[model samples]
Target: MTLPDHGGLSGPEEIARFIDDPLTSSVLTSMADICLVLSPEGRIKAVSSKKGSPVTGVVAGWKDKVLSELIDSMSTEKMRKRVDQLAKDAASPEVSPPRWVELLHMLGQGETLPVRYALHLLHDKRHVLMLGQDQRPTIEMQQMLLNAQIALERDHEAQREIDTRYRLLMDFTSDSIILVSVGSGLIVDINHNAALMLARTRGDLLGKSLADYFADHTRDSLVAGLEKPVQVGSAAMMEVEIKSSQRRLQLSGKMFRASGEQLAIIRLSDPGAGVVADERLTSNLRQLFNHGSDAIVFSDRDGNILAASETFLNLTDVPSASAVRGRSLAEFLARGAVDLRVLLENARRAGQLRMYATKLNTDFGAQVGVEISATWLDDQFDPVLALVLRNASSAGAVRPDTGSGQDQNMQGVIELVGSSTLKDIVSETTDVIEKICIETALELTRNNRVAAAEMLGLSRQSLYVKLRKYDLVSKDEG
Candidate 1:
């Protein structure tokens, strides 16, 4: 069917035809993704949206609302400026090209959608039309790409920082470090010291074989050492003469795995050169132990003094280590045999005794109260016991025999005062106490002779003699 041309109709007839035409609304709706008719004052006059679009939710109840209420803060000023520009252009004969402004449309649920819009001035000059293209998907894609780029930059920066620190440490250290390829045995990298030791520039030695730099007679040994697996905490030391360095040089090699490759770490040092103990260090240690407040003494398992510090001599009223060496520690302990024997036994059983109350008996018969911290050093070559005696008298008066059991025993002694002579009463009391103590020690040790002897501060023979004297031992134990 042929359509009549609107040019052939009169002015009034054209107006009537245009008002009755469905294409008027259809053309406005299809102009863009969204269409808005805004009054000269920047208020929304009418709104239309494309089917199945995000703008549909945005334009739901926007009619007659101001443009500031319809868009986000960032776009409110842009919309006002566009309306003012259109009003100014309405009076000008020369029409300006459509100006596009990117805006964020505010939806009912408080979500904002990005939209790029252009304003067109109507002939009536009282209203303007806005055509928008959805910019949400484009903006989201750009943002995601920007985030990925930023992460890539951060990774590169971190790797560069690590490389800088590693390079600084490698160059600053004095030890020669060489990285060799396990597959080809070629030098992969070398520090400055290694290059200087090899008498070759680093660039010249970068790809050279490790064994080629050693003396002709030692090349085979170096090659064999490279083939050996490197175990942690184990090192193989050998002597090699470099071509430039005529002196015998010590080479120690150990195996390590890094970045999926096994490599040998060979260190170079002067032969027969090692850290020697400084005389001042030994002097310091001697002064520390000999003059310190705590008296330190070293003894054998049998409680024979192996060595005694000066503090020990002062505590025991001895002149020097010579005065106490090889002497039984029991002679100086106030309890005689009992204290030293119990100390050694406990040190062996528990590795250490923290605080054991005892008395240091001086040759002048003065008793110095002390607490002993003893440790048993079970050395393979020279086993010994180390005792640290701290002065306990300074803390308080000497500890009294104030137990309930001791009180009762004293009471028994008191009760015999009127019944018998002092000598007879003392002999009877001593026998009864000895028998009870022997029985208690046997019970405490679960009938073990060696342990019981140690607990009672007696030799095995002495304990057996006492057991026989008191008839405290069973036939099986004897």
Candidate 2:
């Protein structure tokens, strides 16, 4: 029987055959999957498989069979079900768009491995055209692409969780936290503690610049990334003079990186709590020594006084708060304040407060302190002393003899404290602390520094500066 040309409605095989280009025909013939075209009345039109299929070879012989017997019984179950679905879909008055399914399909010698299939129905929905491709490689490529996408999503999710945890810790942590944009000095973030420390609400702190808090020197140093020395206490605060209502506090902190900003976490401390004025002036060394019995004084280990005992106060008629806060002990020589030298030298030789007598013309008149004693506390060059000046003069009266070493009232006192030098003791004590880390490491550390510079993530040069600041050098075995 002769066939209708049907315009461009030819099947895939027929189209491949009509192509005069040998290269394209050769390529398409090697791999393709197709279905037989049947008219609405159930007559065969053309078989659409590529050239090598045995099924395509038998299409003309099955022209008289009903649609139910058309597919071979030995065909794969997947093919049989697909053919049945297509035939049933054709008989319907109207059918929905076929799902765009891509199946694995092979070429001439292999099984159908991958085929991207799409069925397009005419406006009447009675006739269907199936388009397919040998899509095995394409399907594998797509699956691999999908797997990579899933892995990337998982990694992104994990990173997001870590970022969230870090933010939460910074926000709710107890330590004062301030986030400054490293370049601009703009206060990008401030936690509740930092806000409170600044005496500003978090809202007030958010946009305000760091200049709001820094003093002239400190501010300039910070901008220049230069190190500035700061005192870290509250009682007798190292006052930072302010120009206006803005208060500048001398505080110390470490520079660190956070949230893309180089900021500082300055932990502030209260100076000794409720310490009296005299107690405040006394260097930290004095009170720790002599079990609180020995009267303490802060003077330059060179005898420049920073503080003096209540007895020293009474002996000199100096009020604890006023008369002798910053004045060096030598400044009172005109006021009959006894030279603390002889006793200090004796204490240095003895390592502890040693009893000695001295006749001195103090405010209480020329007096003899029979049990006078003095001792250096530590070897860090701090002005610290332990003294027990005994008022051995006539009760409430001046000493009878105020002349010389042969003075009649001068009493011989026993130097009961031992005879080791103060420096020797401090040197030995520091050695004990330095032994845990290597001597080189300790010398490479600072401020009675940690076990080692490397352990603290600090360079030896930094540690060296700190040791020098604390007056600790190779002499300090510690």
Candidate 3:
């Protein structure tokens, strides 16, 4: 087993002895997944696979078969050429490195195995040694990487589609919308409508402070309101005048979190932009509805109150417009459903009813004679009846039988004459007159109980007693 003093075998006899050793096959199988001894004509003379290799049983029957038969048809010519080249190299005197070729081996049952084979020239020169590395694991790794790339591309495409939809919605919406960063108070994004509203281009608006477009006095309040938590029943919008145009607009905002950062989405809209053709005319009409002397009430087709102006609330003795909203308008009519039915019928038939005489019953059980003008608004989306009520007594309308010179209060008392006994009528009339006088005094004194008591010639304690009896004691007063 010992070699001569040289690093390699000394003669052909020693090399042949080493190749025939029992350990040589084990050594070759350990170095490669599969080892094959091929004849000069490319036929498989012998086959050996490493222990526990996947191709061990697959290649077991390949001995004495042509090498090209075990591989796929595509690899047949390549195998032939490699074997021919190896045979030529073996016949030459020059030594060369082993040549490696990748081949696809056709395993039966529609399966294929990839193997990288290196052709080694044997010392006998009549045969070639083909050592192959199992490329299945490497090929499987490459397939896994390909699948991952495909999945990534699909996910990227899906993300792009979502982004495109979001952009379209933001651009096409009619409302003026702007996105601002909470930390920086700077504009992050703005839609076309918002840019037009602010009198600026989208490029000029981005990365700029939102307050820069608003009046100096309102900038701080506007930003603070945007950052505050939204509350139900809170004022959703505020009036702001644009610095450039001096045009007033309603600004409303909502706060939301995105990408782990806080953002504010604000909407700026003209108060009368969509509702009317002329903004100034709309403003004038709005002021008239809110502050006019006449009471105005909007009711749905079903006679339910949709909205009420400030004067309407005052006339009905209600605390706020919300208190009467959604309630049947019949509740405030003197004859209840009878009066409401007549007003609705007449308005619908004629498109408008002019100065229909009726009485409005207040929450405090007092009735005021009113002349109602009802107009049917047949809006396609929201049909409503607009009723404007003028106080008949304040308008100096003549009272029937009570004489033109008779006061309205006395006329009301006189009207109850035939319905009740003399004593009952007197008692009720006294109470009614007293309550009216007390209310008038309070109104004249601007709700100052002390001054009202002085004006009414009553002590503070007595005034309080009468206030409680009339249920006119306000929460602050109590």
Candidate 4:
């Protein structure tokens, strides 16, 4: 199969023979999705489509149909104009090349197809050939791009809203706050209050070294302190004199990370503005309660814990102070409600109670001997009780001798002579000794029945039975 020389086809017969060949139809179908031959009257003479093409089934019944009838109403005018132009070009003595036109074809069933077509005047000049390429794939890609642009705009708007709120909060706060870059030690941001305190505008403070406002002697230490890690509740604090005013100020700083960079948030306050003689003393007392070896607790008048120190949490085998807050303090006492009642009553009468002995029950089921000092704080609005507990187990060896009661009981048991039957006398002596031993064990263990039972070589069940017989267990314990 060979094509004719590029010079020209030999004659009209040869050209007509080539157009009617099967290979010509295959070549035309390969170049476009749909091909149509129309008569000079604008009726379709024939239609052809590529094998397996989507448009093949759509145009299968289009043969002999008028071109305008197959297209949308809007495209009918366009078709008429293009056909008239082609006729004019064909009639002119000067030869004109085929021209491409785009049209929308109605496929019925609420569907439409877009196609680009080129019209060629045949050698006979009585029929027109139309070649069309589908435009649906390109249209779909453009729609996807439009949707993506809309989503990106919405996300950007949301981020801007959040940034605006954060700026408002920082500007309106009463406390003096400053943000500094950790690496450069330069001010990154300053609030309205901080600028006023420094006697400068916010714009002047930003991008300046934070240490420039402090005395020369303290600059190095202040910058170094801010670079270190700070715990959540405890920030590093220092006192320094301002360079301009010569007035002393307290500075505290906390380190945080933002936007992949380390930053420090610093707070500044005047040391003398709200000074009270007892304020320093109160701060010292608070420090002692937090870091002291003794466990301390503050509770409401009803015995529910309001606050507890770290030492108290450790003593009770609890993880954090928040776990014990708002819970009854008696839950950790060995004698439970009995011990709490005594402490409250004595402290209320005497204003304070000292050396109140008890046992602490740990979460792990162990008991520890402790001596508590309780004070009743009667404030006008809110009254509370403060308790300090110290471990007494190590001091057991140095405890003063107080066994006079046991000695008296033993003496009475010995005085039981042979006046009654021997068996009766022996039985009476056993009761006195048993009662004395129970009392001694209870005193040694700080009234912890579990500890007292282990000390007396008895099971917890047996200890309970004996305690019931001797009427020693409190009603709460029972």
Best prediction by TM-score: 3
Residue pairs of candidate 1 with colliding backbone atoms: 230-255
Better of 2 and 4 by lDDT: 4
Assess every candidate by TM-score: 0.46, 0.36, 0.50, 0.46
Candidates ranked by TM-score: 3, 1, 4, 2
Global lDDT of each candidate: 0.74, 0.51, 0.78, 0.78
lDDT of 1 by residue, 198-291 (tens): 8899999998887777775444566576555366477766777776667577778776788798777777776454434566678888898868
Q: Which stretches of candidate 4 lie over 4 Å from their true place?
A: 1-32, 35-39, 45-57, 81-102, 118-131, 216-224, 230-242, 246-248, 274-478
Candidate 2: regions farther than 4 A off: 1-99, 102-112, 120-130, 134-153, 164-174, 213-222, 225-248, 251-478
Error of 3 at 472 (Å): 75
Candidate 2 per-residue lDDT, tens place, 85-204, comes to: 766777787854573544332223433434465644433545434455645556678999999999999999999999899779877787666655545667777777767666778888
Candidate 2 RMSD to the real structure: 20.0
lDDT (Cα) of model 4 = 0.78
190-303, model 3: which lDDT tens digit per residue? 999999999999999999988878885344576687656467634346677789999898888887889999888888888776576577788898999999999988999989
User: Candidate 3: TM-score?
Assistant: 0.50
Q: Candidate 1 or 3, higher lDDT?
A: 3
